[model samples]
Target chain A: MRPYLYIAKVRMLSALAYRFDVLSSIVIQCLAVIASCFFWIAAYGNQQAALGVTRDQMLTYTVMSSTLACLLTMNVENRIAASVQKGSVALDLLKPVNIFGIYLWEDIGSVAIAFLQNAVPLLLIGALFIVAPVPASAAHFLLFILSAAFSYMINWLIAALFGMWSFRIVRIFPLLCMKGHMIRLLSGSVIPLWFFPQWLQTVLSFLPFRYIYQLPLSVYIGILSPRETAAQMGIQFIWILLLGCLFFEIKKGVTRHLLVQGG
Target chain B: MPLIKVNDLVKEYTVIKKGKGLKGALKSLLHKEKEILRAVNHISFSIQHGEIVGYIGPNGAGKSTTVKMLSGILSPTSGEILIDGLSPQKDRKRVVQNLGVVFGQRSQLNWDLRLGESFELLKRIYRIDDRQYQENLAMMDAILEIHKFIHTPVRQLSLGQRMRGDLAAAMLHSPQVLFLDEPTIGLDVDGKQAIRKFVKEINRLKQTTVILTTHDLGDIQELCSRLIIISEGTIVEDGSLSDLIDRIAPYRILHVELYEEAELPIHPLAEKIRQDGTAAVYRFDKKKVTAAQLIEDLSCFCKMKDFRLEEARIEDIIRAAYHKKEKLEGV
Candidate 1:
């Protein structure tokens, strides 16, 4: 545990080392959020409400979900794939500490830094200009925070599980790109699930992607009732457990076929 | 019992046979042809505590593969490795706590952080107590002198400095077994000497068993008490340096400068291979003929101005050993 904490600490320091890269990413995320808010505003054109929600609610959802997207995205897949390609994964496996735990802590460290650098600024910009709605009450806000934590875990586990494929596949970048596009389209980060067709909505509800962005953002906007939020949070926990198990299963296969690329 | 024991270890890699061009790529996608390459082929050896053994072989001879298997980075296809009576594959975390590995071509240090920070991370990872950590640091510093660049970022340090830092990092936990895969590679004379000295001191003080793979014969001559030479994924020779030389290169060269050129009389155990002006060269088998007896027999006929005995060079000896296996396999 101490080792894991130190790994996270070292990761955090390294993530913060590149000031220009951090600043540029923050700018890009800010543009993405503002563009998303404007897109929602244009879609809602002169209408007080659509899909059982007002324009303000839709705007709030867009801002919060986009911000969450920026916060929850973890690059562990790319990191792992690159390490595998370069054969540095052997060095990582030499440590006594768990390799998966190292990836998780490194993600935590980078995400913690990203939160300070990207999410806070984007949220402040959203609040100042778009006038996004606050949570309905303190309880809803607490639930949103809890759901967001689960969202991070789910997103990270998905990335890590996908990263395990690098052990078997030579070209992983295209697959990773496909995963990103799928998550963006399905997780309701770009377009809220409410706007999707009924069949797509049902499909998403059955999938874990919705828990990554839509569920937490919905809680933040106070759209879900108390009972619904409880049920959804339970579903989020289930997704975490399921994904966690899948990750370990894939990890077992990965170790069995582990090929250190270069000496 | 030996601190480390390996029995008939083997590692095989499955390489996909892909042809050239887009047609081959498409064909490979549909019908993959797989080839199994046995990198470490049923090789077996053991090392006792505090022994600095050189695990040497030519490139792609499975030296790195063997090290990886021993360190639990790669699972062996068959056979068993016991580090202090524990299998690294079955008990990786426990076994790794007592083992340290260093690859000269790749570094384990975090390039983003200062060297000290990397050491700190290793300390926590290994759960070394503060007292032990401090003592080890002192020992490493005394030998490696890593403090000169401890505060420098790993990327900023020179290759020599980084190697020193890496050595210190691996030692921070005071591991009992150390695996160094070309630790002195790509280093200057001073850097190589520093690493060699460090290995010697660590083994002497801590009784840490070291298995090193290196192409540099100087390292073998200075550090390793025993040599394990692998060729074509098999042990070609394993013994002391002198013993190996004697086996692969069985004779010594004697250069004698006589007062005048003459037909050199040779004993049954010695062969006169070269004669130029007043100088003559005789190759003699050490097992059968002593240099003194050969010199006495030759000197009685002609007053020898000067004479010298030369053993075979280690490079030639190793090359012969490596080729000896290839010739046998060819047959």
Candidate 2:
């Protein structure tokens, strides 16, 4: 608990060191989301609706997903992989604590700070420009929270799994970039799943990548009913639990190799 | 009880050999070759409670590998290691509580935070009680003079200051066994002496057993009583430092200054390493050719102005051991 708090304090302080990086990240995200909001509003200037989504609902989805993207720009994989390359991970391994726990707690601490100090402020600015959807109802709010929890697990596992690849190569960044881009593009992080062609949307629905972006956005936009949202959240949890196990196993193997043949 | 025990510890490595330059880099992409390296060959040793032992080796002689295994950072390949009677690999978190380690090339302190903050963080990680923490801090500050820069971040601390800070950090929890890997490296004469003094003091005061691995022969010569020298992944010699030097390769070197320029001495028991106008260096076998006998022969043969007898230094003895090891390996 002490180390966790200590590390978290450092994690929080690190963001404050670079004020411009935080400000710009928030500003760019807000402006881009607003621009997209206007583009959608103008497109549906006179039409009643498009594909069961109203102009207001689409605007709501736009604001929330944009905010969520900024909120969840963890880049945990990049951090861990960079540590691997720099040999800093060796220092962490020497401590009398669980390496996995330390990384996980630090991840939570750092990302939590990023979201509060960067993403929340950006979301507020987006709300000033457009009507961000509040949750449709109390029941839907709980469902959305469940979905977001699942969403976090999926992102964390994918990032950790890629990070463990440092044993194989010095730089996992380029590969992480390519893989993340593919996931973002398919999961509708840069766009909305509602805009995708029907078949593509259906295929994306069956993939776990949706848990990272589309499902959270969909629930916020009132796209799914109570039962449907529950099912989606369940799927997200199943994937999280399953991948979490694999992530730990790979980490164990990678740690062993590192300790034996240290850089 | 033995504070540290290792049995049949082994570590094998596969090294990727890549050529130099652009052509070699490209060729490597198509056909990559690997070389097998056995770092720590099958070996076993145990340190009893409160024993300060020196682990010595030539470069690439598996010193660090063995330290890593004993400290619980690395898992042995085909053996068992028990520090305080628990397998480090099986129960790393628990085993780590019983051990403290310092690496010369690395510091565990936070780079951007004050030394106080770093110590506080360690206090939390090790979960030291408040009363004990304060007592230890006071004792460390008195011995290490850590108070001067307790507020300074680790990056701003001098190398000597940082070494002391690292020592304090490793000892914050007051573990039973301390593993120091080149703790005195890259320090000035004062810094080295200060660290050596502190390590010795703690071993005496706290009865903290220390297994130190160092290339600095001076540290070994000053601090350690028991010595273990390994080369080519095998433990070539293990015993008291003086005993190893005595049993094998005990030779005294003699330097004689002639009253006038003279030719080198020719003898079966001694070999002339070099000779100038007035002085000549002769390496003599103390077992067969005594220094007294060499002196008698030199006095009778030439008009000797002066002569000096030198005892074998640990560096020279260790060098001989390493070279002898290489010869045996036919490397």
Candidate 3:
């Protein structure tokens, strides 16, 4: 446990070493959030409500979802792919710590730093210009935070499972690009599920992407009742368990692949 | 019992067989061809408690693969590796706790962090006690002189400094077995001396078992008590350096300059391989005839102006070992 924490701490310090990269990413995410807010404003022009959502709720949804998208982004797959290609993954496996634990803590360190450098500033800037609604209750805000935590775990597990593919296929840029597009279109980061047709919504309910953004952002903006938030949180946990099992299975294959191929 | 033992270890890779031409590429895309490459064939060796064994081989000879398997970075396809009575594949964590590995071409330290910071992270990762950690640092600092640039970022350090840092980092945990793949590679004479001295110091003080894979024969001559030469996924030769030299290159060249042009002295054990004017060179087996006895005999026949003896060089011995099959084929 102490070792993993130290890994995270070292990773955080390393991430902070590139001040210019961090600052530029923060600026880019802020621009993304601001652009989404304007797009929502134009889409909802002269309408008090559309698709069972009030204008203010829609504005909050757009801002929160975009900010969450920026905050919850996990690129563990890129790290895994780069390490495998560089042959440094051997050094990683040499350590006594669990490989997945190292990646998890490293990603946590990066996300934690990004939250401080990007999410806080972006949300503050968004609050000043956007017509965002406050949470329906204190419980809703707390539950939204909880839901976002679950969202991060689900996102990380999915990214880790995807990263395991790198052990088999060294070049994963195309796969990564496809994953990004899928998340953007299906995870409700760029577009809310409320705007999608009922049939698409039914299809999405069976998938895991919506839980990444829509479920958490809806709770944050007071769009979901307390009971529905609880149910959705349950679904998030289920996804975590499912993805966790799949990650371990893929990890076994990765270990065997590395052993045979001498990565 | 030996501290490290490997038994008939094997690792095989299935590589896609890509064709050369554009048409062959298209054909391969439809029905892919695969070939099995055995990187490490049935090779086995054991090392005792404190020994510096130089594992040497040419490129693509499976040196790194063996090191990787020993360090628990890769599992053997079939066979057993026991590090201090524990299997690295079965008990990786426990085995890794006592293992340290360093790759000359790759660093384990974080590029963004200071050298000290990286050491601290390793300290935590290995769970070295405060006192032991300080003692290890002091020991490493004394030998490696890492304190000179301990605060510098890893990327900012020169190659020598970075190599020192890497050596120190690998030792911070005080691992029992150290695996160094090309430790002295790409280093200046001074840097190489520093590494050699450090390796000697740790082995003396801590009795650490070091398995080093290097193409640098200087490292082998200066440090390793035993040599293991692998070629084409098999151990071609394994013995003391002198024994290997004797087996592959048995004779020493004795250059003798006589006072006048005369018939070279003929001895039963010595052969005059080269003669130019008054200069004659005799090749004699050290085991059969000592250089002093041969010289005394030669002086009785001719007045010698000058004479010098040269032993077989390690480079020639190693090169001969690498091409042993070729030499046999020529014979």
Clashing pairs in 1: none
Per-residue CA lDDT of model 1 for B1-331, tens digit only, reads 9998999999999999998999999999999999999999999998999999999999999999999999998999999999999998888889999998889999999999999999999999999999999999999999999889999999999999999998998889999999999999999999999999999999999999999999999999999999999988999888898887766677888999998777788677898888898999998888998999999999888989999988777787777777763211100
Interface DockQ of each model: 0.86, 0.49, 0.68
Q: What is the interface RMSD of each candidate, in Å?
A: 0.7, 2.3, 2.1
lDDT by residue (A184-254, candidate 1, tens digit) is 99998887888899998988888999999889988888888889989989999999999999888778778
Which candidate achieves the best lDDT against the true structure?
Answer: 1
Candidate 1 stretches with Cα past 4 Å from truth are: B274-277, B325-331
Per-prediction TM-score, chain A only? 0.96, 0.91, 0.94
lDDT of 3 by residue, A1-263 (tens): 99998988998899889989988987888788788778878988999888778778877887777667767778689988888887888888889888889999988887788778887787787788775446767888898889899899989988888888888888887998898899889988888887899999999999999998988888887877778878989998899999888888777767767732332
Ten consecutive residues with minimal summed lDDT in candidate 3 chain B?
Answer: B322-331
Residue B142, candidate 1: C-alpha displacement in angstroms: 0.2
User: Cα RMSD for candidate 2?
Assistant: 3.9
Q: Candidate 2 residues A166-215, lDDT tens each?
A: 76677677898888788879887767776788999888877778888888
Ranking by lDDT: 1, 3, 2
Task: Rank the candidate models, highest DockQ first.
Answer: 1, 3, 2
Top-scoring candidate (TM-score): 3
Error of 2 at B81 (Å): 1.5
Model 1 reproduced share of reference interface contacts: 0.85
The C-alpha stretches of model 2 lying farther than 4 A from their native spots are A1-6, A38-48, A259-263, B19-24, B254-305, B325-331
**Between the candidate structures 1 and 3, which one is better when assessed by DockQ?**
1
TM-score of 1: 0.96
